[model samples]
Target: MTSALLEQSVVETPSSFRVLTGDRPTGRLHLGHYFGTLHNRIRLQRLGVEVMLIIADYQVLTDRDLAERLPEHVEDLVLDYLAAGFDPGRGTVFAHSAVPALNQLLLPFLSLVSTAELSRNPTVKDEIAHSRQAAVSGLMFTYPAHQAADILFCKANLVPVGQDQLPHLELTRTIARRFNDRYGKVFPEPAPMLSAAPLLLGTDGTKMSKSRGNAISLSATADETARLIKGAKTDVERHITYEPQRRPEVSSLVLLASLCQDRDPHEVAEEIGSGGAAALKRTVTSAVNEFLAPIRARRTELARDRRYLRQVLRVGNARANEIADSTLAEVRRAMRTVY
Candidate 1:
């Protein structure tokens, strides 16, 4: 029999189906955020799945020390999530630091996993290489188990992730299997619901990232968008073309405008043929502003209501803890931790 079939006979499955997903609260959301995960979150919530948006603030420390600006960053991140249409009413949006039980799972989970397996993880290795931090911290090294704790704490069944994150999810699944085999079947093997848009590059033709300075923040003012678009590099050919491989710069602007306006970049290129870079930049800038106008307004309004955001997080933490506590209790019983 196949491994899938053989393994199925060993672990008992649960009745509830849930999804766990979130972003680190280091910065604000951007267009890449829209096409990648924000829009999908809205659709998923509508599908009646129990959604949990974890503000992985604690995870942020795996790379950089955000001990000073983290509070502001967290608030801004919350505002961005709210502005992007993640409804607290439909699902839970919580900070990782706020949920002690979720983090508490890490201690027990680490006992179930090994150092060699963690070192083999592609995501962790890549992160270590990118951060260039010599001798990665113990916390950073054991992130996959912590991630497992995040999922298993809530008994999440589905984890929406980009293909790049598949390895990490696999690690989480491995941890779950280990726990089930050694302790008892308490955590589900959370499968990945691959993000629809895999890759979105920055204006600089690199991956859109906050550190790269190419991201157009969701909260960027109209003036900021216009200025950034003006500086956006385009082809020196004096003509607009749709060839991404051949003309990446101009093509990137086209892609940005298309995503902002919900139109085809090829069609946009045709409409702006021979009109040149200036025309394309103006159109793209205007489209971006129009697209983000409502979101910016909503964000401003939401910003004034910090109390609401705190309440939302508090409520979400309570709900998240309830699930986590029950799961931990079950785990303790399975492992015979309780007398």
Candidate 2:
């Protein structure tokens, strides 16, 4: 039987199915990101869904001390989006810091969610542990509220997320329901459009993350990608196999190749088994480099035309502000705070 979320994707009207998905402008996106969410974003756009991509610049500040390089990070992220086929004409791509209304919506959303509830969020707890912060900031604790504001401000009814993000989406739904019950029905409880894409592991055979320095960046040069994959950690087993439990590192390579070649990882593993890890590495490196060559070239071309890039964001920001303003006006009216 098809899941409710999957059924929603098929039956919902394009005009009614608004999608909101984004990435933090912390660093260049990687292959893991490409397969995980970016690919889904592109598919949603093609399906005529009202897609909104946010550059979560402010969210980056929850853990970091300064955003000195934020501008650069945002620019790079825009280029990656363009190269990955996110057409500005089809969907809006705006920065979180650019929309004032989104921030304003956060105030009321904070009241709906309690401090204890935020503290209990598994995602928040995981991030806190990952950051290893001596003291967690209030902003960090309330990040989920900020995300709810992002979704509700756009009135997005569908949020494309991975399995790891279900808790965050659930919180958004709870806040929406609570607000509507207290004030009035001014928001749709957004549903999770869970991705069916295979999860790509970092070269080190763990979670693909920029902080870990194990990711193959989307903008990496052919040589840089090869170098990263060449030095990737693998097991002592001579033959290649798809035993993720016992040989995660080797299996990660197979998964990468499978994604690149559109073949099964198990088949890829078996095909390269006779040649051992060296052969698997070569296959993975070649597949990844070939896959990224065109994307990198397009990104490099887009980077040179800085004015066009700025205009894309400017247009998207303006439209986003208009939508957000309309939603905020309704919210204020619902709460009887129009004055």
TM-score of each: 0.91, 0.96
Q: Which prediction has the highest TM-score against the true structure?
A: 2
Q: Name model 1 segments beyond 4 Å from true.
A: 1-16, 132-135
Model 1 poorest ten-residue lDDT run: 6-15
lDDT tens string, model 1, 1-339?
A: 333542242233322457888888878888888788887776667656668888888888887644448877888877898897888898998889988778878987888778898888888888888874556787789889988888889888877788889888988888889989998788889877766573567877788888789989999999998988888777679889878889887887888788888888899999988989999988899889999999999999999989888888889889988887888789889889898
> Clash number for every model?
0, 0
lDDT of 2 at 130: 70
lDDT of 1 at 171: 84
Query: Which one is best on lDDT?
Result: 2
The 0-to-1 C-alpha lDDT of every candidate, in the order given, reads 0.82, 0.88
